[model samples]
Target: MGSTSSGRSTGARDRDGEGRARNARPRDGLGRPLPYEAQGVARQPEGIVRTPEQSVAEAQGLLDAGRPFHAHEVFEDAWKSGPQEERELWRGLAQVAVGLTHAARGNVTGGARLLRRGAGGVEQWAAQSGRQRPYGMDLVGLVAWGRGLADDVEAGGGTVDAQARAPRLRGQVP
Candidate 1:
């Protein structure tokens, strides 16, 4: 690394062909950037469109694997690609996933705040849409779970077990 005249290190930044800054760094399960030479978990490709069922399944799988950061990306895709009216729902889900990621990464304050915000977003969306079980998701239950997790994380004041605390997106399975 070379130092610039302004005393900043002149490290090469990852950029796309168009000169847009795009970080190509490998990331850990919680989305923390790793050293360039370190092997990391494969990242979720962005902007892929999927059916609602597919989105739920994929995000749920990531969540189960304790990769809430990746799960958040899946939900972000849904928020971008899904119907406009449902954007809030997907965005809220993404926020909840990110909250879990923060919790797992030991940022208790950020984790709790995001969780509460996400839960509130989803709860309000559900109330307005009157679709409590959209795409097999139990919105009411998810809201309660997210809020409860927020409270617990704040109370505990430490990193949470992401896998142990993963939310059940749907209601009881048969």
Candidate 2:
């Protein structure tokens, strides 16, 4: 209910005001708002900043190195930070990693289910994002391969053939 010098009731103080919200924290050294600043900045948590393509590249490296679990963790981190519109793609990638981990552990049924779920996620992303085409070489591709392997297993077939053809899940590119 306080009025500013211009005779306007300023519900909140501006940056120059010493009587600003007590909970407000100072700006950081970079002249940006501090991490805990409660006011003067929108509270929306920033999403992971890296592009999905970058995530894919990193995940591929992990796959090449035979580190499905690590790749899954990366995808999960990306998925959490990706925009809402692209969250599914990251999740799909992570799911595929999980599927691969299960396969490596000899949990065929679990792997199959995870792969199918990943495929569904990527397929949905494709429909929503309108990328290359049906099962393009991206999240969609990862998911499609997972689904294919899952289906192969369900049909009493050796899914290793599909795994062999699947894009590398991780590796350190020399």
Candidate of highest TM-score: 1
Predicted structure 2: lDDT: 0.61
Candidate 2: list runs displaced more than 4 Å. Answer: 1-49, 133-136, 154-174
Candidate 2 per-residue lDDT over residues 18-118, each given as its tens digit: 55444244432112355342343222122345566666776666666555656676778788986788788778878877776666555679878888888
- How well does model 1 score by local distance difference test? 0.92
Instruction: Give every collision pair in model 1.
Output: none
**Worst ten-residue run, lDDT, model 1?**
3-12
Q: Rate the local accuracy (lDDT) of all candidates.
A: 0.92, 0.61
lDDT tens digits, residue span 21-55, model 1: 97887898889998766799999998899999999
Q: Candidate 1, which segments miss by more than 4 Å at Cα? A: 1-10, 172-174
> Relative to the unseen true structure, what is the C-alpha lDDT of residue 121 in candidate 2, on a scale of 0 to 100?
83
Best by lDDT: 1
